[model samples]
Structure formats: C-alpha cells, structure tokens
Target: MNAVKTGSHAASTLEKTPVGDLVDGKGHSSGAEWLTRYSTSLMGVFGTPQRVLVRGAGCLVWDADGKEYLDLLGGIAVNALGHAHPFVTSVISSQLATLGHVSNFFTSPTQIALAEKLLALTHAPPGSKVFFANSGTEAVEAAFKLARRNGASPDGTTGKRTKIIALEGAFHGRTMGALALTAKEAYRAPFEPLPGGVVHIPFGDVAALEAAIDETVAAVFLEPIQGEAGVRPLPPGYLKAAREATTKAGALLILDEVQTGIGRTGKWLATEDAGIVPDAITLAKGLGGGFPIGALLTFGEQTSSLLAAGQHGTTFGGNPVATAAALATLHAIESQRVLENVAVVGDYLRTGLAAVDGVTEVRGEGLLIGFDLDAEVAPAVVTAGLDAGFIVNSPGPRTIRLAPPLVLTKDQTGTFLAALPAILRTAKDAQ
Candidate 1:
C-alpha cells in the first residue's frame, strides 16, 4: 500500500508536464524538465520518454516525485548487479580520482585486467585479445570488422567470403555494421543501403541456417538468446549445427552476447549453455554494471592482426573509471554469487508467470524472462503493472518481458506476482 501510494506521486508529476514544454523551456530543475530538454536535443530514435527516474538503489528506482518502483526491466538487461552497488561506485570513484581516461596508445591496469578476466572466463586460448569500445553497437561493429579481416578467401582479398549470416528477429545494434546484421525492418528501413553483404535466416531453424551459410559466407552471427525478440531461446542443437556448418565452410562464428553475458543468463556467457566457442564474442550491456563500456574478444587463429594501430579507436572506450566499474562488477558477481541468485530468482519469477492467466508461454533463462499473452493485450498489461507500481515492458504486441535486476529478492517477486492477477484483470477491463 505504501508503494502504491508513493507510485501515484511519481506518475502525477510525469503526467502534469507536457514533454514538449520541458524540452523547449528553460530554468526548470525537475527530472521532468530534464527529460523535456533531453527530448528536444536528443534524437527521436527511442520514441517518447517514460517516467524520469531520479535515483536508484538495489533493484528499486524512484521517479522524479520520489515514488519507488521495482525495476523489472533492469535498464534492458544491463544492470547485472543492480544499480548503485557500493563496489561499483567505489571503484569508479577511486579510479576517476586517480586517472580518469587515457588514449588507446597508452594502457591502464583496469582495462588490461578487465580484458584479461573476460578472456579467461570465456576460456579463450592463450594470446586471445580484446578491443574495447564505447557501447554495444560499437562492439558489434568491431566484431563485424574483425570477422571480415580474418575471412579473406584464397584470392587474398575479401571477394567470395563477403556475406554475414544473421538471424531473423535478431537485434545486434543500430550502428551501420551492426544494423546490417539486425533483422528489424522498422529499425532499418529508414537507413537503407546499410553496410551490405548480410543475409537473414529464421532463428532456431538449423536447416535454414545450413541453407543460407556456405563458402561465400564470412561468418555466422547470432545471439544465443534473442533478447529483443521476446527472449527466445535457441533450440537444442541449433548452435552446435551452426558451429559445425560454419567450420565446414571456413566461416567464423560470432556470438553477440551484449544482452545475455556477464551473468544475466545464469551463466557467464549464454554460448556456454550451447557448448559452442565462437570465434569472436561481442559484449556490453551488463558488463559495466551501469557504466558505459563494450568489448570484443577474439581467440586462437581467428584473432586476426586486423585494425592497424590507427584503424579504429574511441576516446572514452576504455576510460579508467568505467573499466574500474566493470572490474568491480565482475568481482562482485563472482564473490557475491550473483549468478546463483539470478538462477534462483529467475526460476521463481518464471514459475509464477506460468501460473498467471492469459499467459500462453514462458521462455528465457536467468533473470531475463518473457511470457506471451494469449491475445494482443501486452500493452494493457504493462500499463496495469505500471499503475500497480511495478515497472515492466511489452517487447512485442503479445509478449511481456521481465529483465529484473539480479538483486531483486524473492519477497519483491512475490509482491509483483500477488498483484499480477488483478493487474491482468485490470488490463482486460481496459481492453
């Protein structure tokens, strides 16, 4: 009841202000005002804004009005250990105070340590190297370029081996190279002539993949669990078949682990669940806890000596503060046994979701869960959940996605599950 009461205050503040007014106005100092300013100057890539959160701790965030919400979306599966964890904050602060950033030509211990840890955890072979970037899109772009560099045909030029095989309903990123790999027409139509030489195959279809990938294909790119496509899991043996096929064709295998890596999937990497070791793995999202950082890991002979000294670089890609934040995040996940928590809480949420009415199916692993609605009422369900003081998402017309913080407790989940049936009823009534 207290949460319910507090939630109203948050929502009221959001509703009272016109998003456009805040974007154009000045001298306003509220979160709503900040959001308005954000909308005006920021590109309209993500559509309209929601509640402007002012602060967060653990799995909870408070909107501008100070109404608390159980963060079930978890910043789209990026808050692996939850928001504002002391370890992450302290490391970031200390690192910033010591040395904030340095160019790529120079190296820092934090960046080197984080890269080494990632490579070690992934079981990459000796000499496997990492190239840091600023975001998931950039990481994927780096992977794409790396895939191409090591994929030249016998002609010694990238003529025959030019195509990349991506999955239908797959979301790589929005940058040019990564966007070419993404299958969503809505995100790609406006920006056509995208980096060419890419093909799309239906996800979870081994035969289709076999048909599409061949000698000319340079690499096979896949998300072990398709997070943006309603958290669909790869069918058993699909990844194995892909690996074998790519190997047979001499095409590399790239796993886009941006959303499922770093313990979001109950494992260090989702590909581990499939027993496949990809040539290159693109990672971001939860890697930095809440800090901005992305990485590309290449192993064995596939770790081509591409990207000459000045080929690709980012000013803030491996900033000491973000790297420190990531190192702390990795340590906390292992020391605090956060992956175990993800498994326990994730299963509980999945079990509760299965018992809910109007849910046609439940899928995904770890804290990333998705349920299909019996009808096209997921939006209504999301709205009802919001009114009930819980933050959730409708990833599709008939699917609800819950990527709750790993720190979310069983009691918090119970609170949401207890309110779910009424939320469903409310959604139906609204429909």
Candidate 2:
C-alpha cells in the first residue's frame, strides 16, 4: 500500500505507523494507516476515511489505535440509545436464539408487536397498516409504490395519476425511485434516466405547494425536518398546509421521517405535533438502534388498501432480530426517560453552541441538532473536532449537523462545547 505522506510530521508518521498491529519495533499505526486496506476492500463512494473506528459504547467510540471520540453523530442518527447499549444487545441475542428469521411468510410475536407499537405511536386513524423493509430507502420505495398504486385508475387504464411532488433540498433516499424525489443535482446527475413522475418545489412555500397540488399528483413527499439539508425544519403550519392541499387535491401526503422519527425531535413522531394525519409515513434509522430496519405506515382505509399482499414484499423486512432490536430501543427510550434528556440537554447544547465563535446559527429539536458555521470550514471543523476527541458531521460546506445519541447528557455535551473553540480555530487556520 502507498503511504501518501505530507509535511514534516508525514515523514515520521509514515515510517513509524504500524502496518496492522505493529511497525518495525516502534509505535502502532491504526488511524489513517488502515485506510489503504479499506480502499482495497471497500467502495470509494463515500470518499476518504475520517478515522478507523473500531468499537463504541454509549456516546463514545474508540479507533483502531485506541483513540477515543465522543460520537455526536450517532451513526448519522441511527443509534437511538447510543452504541452497544446492553438492553439492545440482550434483546437481539434472546430473539436470535429463539426465532431469528421466519421471513414475511410467517410473522413472529416480536415483529407483530413492534408494528402495532409503531402504529400506536403515530396515532393513525381507525385503520392503519405497516409494511416493513430493511432500510430507509426500502421504506421510501414501498411508500412510493403505494402512492403509485393508490393513484392508479381502478381499471388500470391510461391517464393514471403517477406524478409525485417533493420539496427542494429534500433527501428521500438513494434508490432510483427515491433519488427521483431528491433535488440535489450532484447526487442525481450520474444516476439519470431515473424513475420519472417526480417534480420539486420550494420548501415552506404554502402558495407554491397549493399551486402544485392537483388530482394529477399521486403523493406529496416531505420531511417534518430536513435532516440532510442541515436539519432544517418545515416552516410553521407548512405541514398543515400540505395536508390540506393534498387532501383537497386527492393526493397522498407521505412524510419521510427516516431521520426525524423515533423521538429524535423530542416526540414519538414529528408529524404528531402538526396535528395532521398524513396518508403515509416512512421510517428507519433510529427505529432499529443501528440495526437496519424500515417501515412504511399507511393511515385510514384509502391509504391502507393501496398495496395488496403480492403487490409488495420483503425477504428480511421485519426479521425477528431486527424487530427485537427495535422493540428494545423503544423500551429503553421510554423506560430510561431518554427523550426528556434529549429535550433538556439538546436545548442546553444548542444554546451553548450558538454562543461559540464560529457558529452563526443553531437549529433542531431534541437530540438532533444542526448549526451554520460562520465560514465554509465545516469539513475542516469536523476534522479538528475528531482530533480533539469529538465526532461530528458537515453535510454542506458551511453546515454542521449533530444527531447524537438520545442518551447524551449535558456533561458529555459540555466536553464538545469546551473543545469546539479550539477546533474552530484550527479549522480556520487550515482554511
């Protein structure tokens, strides 16, 4: 493997860094040195390695060479109870020991129970059905198909309503159908000729939304809070307006809560606060506490009957182990009172972070927080934070996002807050 070293430190690092476990009787090399092996084995779609992470516990992780970091991103909001939570481990182990995978042909008690729990949390109308998948993309794919199916003419004739309206700067997922709903050109350009029938509009513009909605549209896909676009929440009353417009136009309103759902925003469902019943909701990420699982929820008869048995299915959608993990995560979140912690500590951290030198704006609810950096040094800031034993993400050139574990305490948040000034200074110097 080639060691692309730079500067005076690079010379010593290349010579001294260990090859797997050990160098030539010197120190160990586990952080960046392991990147060569990673490049050889894995795809480069995600770009260069930040660090060689090895293991993690609640709100903290260790790298390959024993370097520790406070994991504030929480696997991009996937870890609800933080890493290696014992409750999650025990549940998975017990469920795996008993009934792991019976497939969709047969359902386990755990799977059915989790589905029912999710349905209750959403407080859907009289009848609601859930279809489980293995990731956020699959949940969205199911919702997309359901919308298309629901809008199809009864006789399967021509002139079927197949169009979907998505928000500008919205990120649904990476699949062809989901990508069509995403508005970023850079993420969509290479995957062109994608599934069509999707159009984008300015988010938070109620008038534009009303103008766009019509009977020709099948579904309106939106996020209560835009996670990838740096955790931007929907404008006040925007969800209600979307619900009204879609209902009036006979279109389904699909809320993609893959990032904001499962109490990330101090609520079981972010849409609940809006007091509007959406036609469908897509969920994943924190639902499984890092275990890959997703679900598509349909409210009321019109939406629930959209997909028939054979119309949609999954091989490992609600496998017992994944469902068990999800149940454990939910139980822990509730029993441990983690959501309260998120509400209290998240506000504290946000208030503190807003006072930092480089931060220009602070936004988000509960454990999911985001801030605008004063300069385009977000990536550099991420690097500096990592060096200072903290982990964060910069979704854009000037946007810094933090979706830490719901269990993160103010003391842990203080650690990051204390180091942020120095990290900002380093990032500015690098820029």
Candidate 3:
C-alpha cells in the first residue's frame, strides 16, 4: 500500500480547509471550482460532494489535494476486492477490448459462466436458473415479477395476489417495483401511489410476518441484514420462522443479499448461516468488483415462467465486460480465501469498536459492522474520521456503519481502530 505521509498534523488540518484554498486558485483544475461546475452540471440527489477523491488503490484513496484516507466504507460496500484489484482490472480490460457487449438475445461464455458460478455459490442444486441485471434493484424487480407469476391462481387470479410483504428499514432499490418494496416513507413518498399492495412489517417479528403474509401475498422480500438501516442483523430464529411462515402461506421468500453477500459477512452468502433456502436470492454490490452487474438466483421449479419470452429485457444487463469482471471477482475471492480474512478482521473491528467509550451497542457479523453512540453524534464522528485521515459513513443519526473491502488488511483495520477513540473524543467535544 502506498502511504501519503504529508505529516499527520497537516493532513488533520487540511480537511477543515476549503477546497478552493487547497487548489492554489487554479480555475477548472481547482477542487472547489470543479465542484461548482459539478453543482451546475449534475443533479442534487447526493447534495454537495463531501470530498473530491481523485485516485485509489486497495483500501486507500487520495483526495484532490493528495491527502490519503483509509477507506472503511469501500464505496458503500461495492468494492469487495477493494479499488483496482489486478484480477478485476485485467478481466474488465481484456473483455472490453475483445467483446465488450452484446444484445440480450445473444449469449456469451462469460455470461453463462457467471450464472453457473452464482448458482454453485448459492448451492441451489443443479438446473437452477439465473437472471442478470444491472443493479440490485433490477435483480429484485426480476425476482418480484417471478414470484408474482408463480403465485398466480389456476383461475388466472394473478391480480389479487399482488400484495408483497417487506420489512421496515429494508432497502431493495430506487426503481418503481423495488421502491414499492422499500419501507422508508421518505423514499416512497416522493413517488406516491407507488405500485399498490406492497405492505411493510417490522423486521425480525415472526408473528407480524405470519399475520401479514397470506394467500393474497405474492412474495415476502427482505434483506438478510438491513444495510441502509445500519447493519441490523435479523434475530437468530427470525429467518427460519419467516421461511416457514411464507411457505405455509404459499408466498415466495426473497432474500436481498445486495449489501450482505459476496463474503462481506464472512460467507459466500450470509443466508448460509441460517441454513434456509429462500425461493429467490438477489445479489449485486460486491458481485462485480465495482463493475456494474446484478443477478437473481432461483432454485428448483420456483424459477417461474414469468414475463413470457419478450416481456422484459435490458440493453447492457449481461454484457461480457461486466460478466467477466464478476467471474474474476468470484475467482479471486475463492482462490485468495478472502472470506477468512473478513472473519478475522471483522472480529478485530468489532472488538476494537466495543472498547470505545459511549458506544452503546455493536452489532452485525463479519466486516459489515455497525455501532451506536450514546447520542446522535454520527455526523460529528464522520467529520472527525475524515480529519483523522479515514473514511466511514453514518446509516442513521446514531449509527455508524463500516463495510470496508474484503481485502482490508490487519494494519489497515488497526489504523482506523487506533484512531477511533480520538475520533469519538473529538465528536463528544463538539457536543
């Protein structure tokens, strides 16, 4: 790893300075001026950019002014192999140059191989099928349609089986069908009258789930660990109970592994720990190693004859470049034993964070960890972390989430751990 030793004192103060001052008044090249242009050119969904990162390698990134940070968030857990892994880069570049994309009506070796690999990892038994999409939301949407198709009555009463059960704090995606399943009212309210019949239930409440799910429901979709809701893991018996209840109700069980899969939880799929096979599994995030790709995996006969033949399609869903990147990502994780590293480093991170004062709770497994402060000081801690040359995120006002790359080393974890106390102290002082 390359270390940007611009002196700790200077680096600490740099974060507090305006980007304009750091750029020496160079117009377009200046970070502030470029951001000004960005504000004019781009939409305001993310608000103002926090930091203008220029480059990255492994688990570290350098800002516009050459300040380095230990990136603990890992691009919101999308960079599973970390930034610019050699294998990922090699596969993407080679495939792009050779045969980048093709129409969905066509097939490619990488696409078939990636689907086969996902089926194998899912342990979905032979003859399982996979559908490719461009993001987690698309994967969920595909599975949602499939479930609706499977739940249709012999009397052709598909419309009545439209209700789908989702958990509170679950985030499937921003698209219409996926947005319908996400429970956050803020995200759904903007586009009110979203696809009707989607119901939200409290996460981990088996009784509530049992009560809500009935013959009217087409599917029950949930995140194994609610990522955007702050790394909240489901209770021990909750997942099994959900599967049983959904099965009894004749509803499909869909597990959204977008943020929790691909060794982030020290397992190929976090649902493996539960020992219950969902009717469908949606995956993305770490799957492409930063390239864009998503997959929906279904087992046995539940694959559903949904959408007929020409009902749904995407222009770049299963492009060769993206498929190759995912294939390489899977190969690298297996060959390098990255899941074991996630387990070891995750334990270290959890133990380290638990030792901090004012940390009321530490939850989650593997590298997808979250902790609560005594107060709503997460934003302050984020600022302090940036000052201390680290990167992190707050999923909520009181919860700090750390979903670093699986390639994060012991030394990298130690750096953030060692700086955490001072970061907390700084946050506390601000109050």
The candidate that wins on TM-score is 2
Candidate 2's C-alpha lDDT? Answer: 0.89
Encode model 3's per-residue lDDT on 220-255: one tens digit a residue. 898889989989988888889988988898788888
Answer with 1 or 2, whichever has the higher lDDT.
2
Task: In angstroms, give how far residue 360 of model 3 lies from its true place.
Answer: 1.2
| Model 1 residue 2 distance off true place after TM-score fit, in angstroms | 49
Q: Measured by TM-score, how close is model 3 to the native structure? A: 0.91
> Which ranking of candidates, highest lDDT first?
2, 3, 1
Task: Output the lDDT of residue 304, model 1.
Answer: 44
Candidate 1: give the clashing pairs. 23-36
Stronger candidate by TM-score (1 vs 2): 2
Tens digits of lDDT, candidate 1, 328-379: 9999999998989999999999999899888889999988899998788888
Clashes by residue pair, model 2? 18-29
Poorest lDDT segment (10 consecutive residues) of candidate 1: 20-29
TM-score for candidate 1, residues paired by index: 0.91
Q: Output the worst ten-in-a-row residue range by lDDT, candidate 2.
A: 18-27
lDDT of 2 at 281: 94
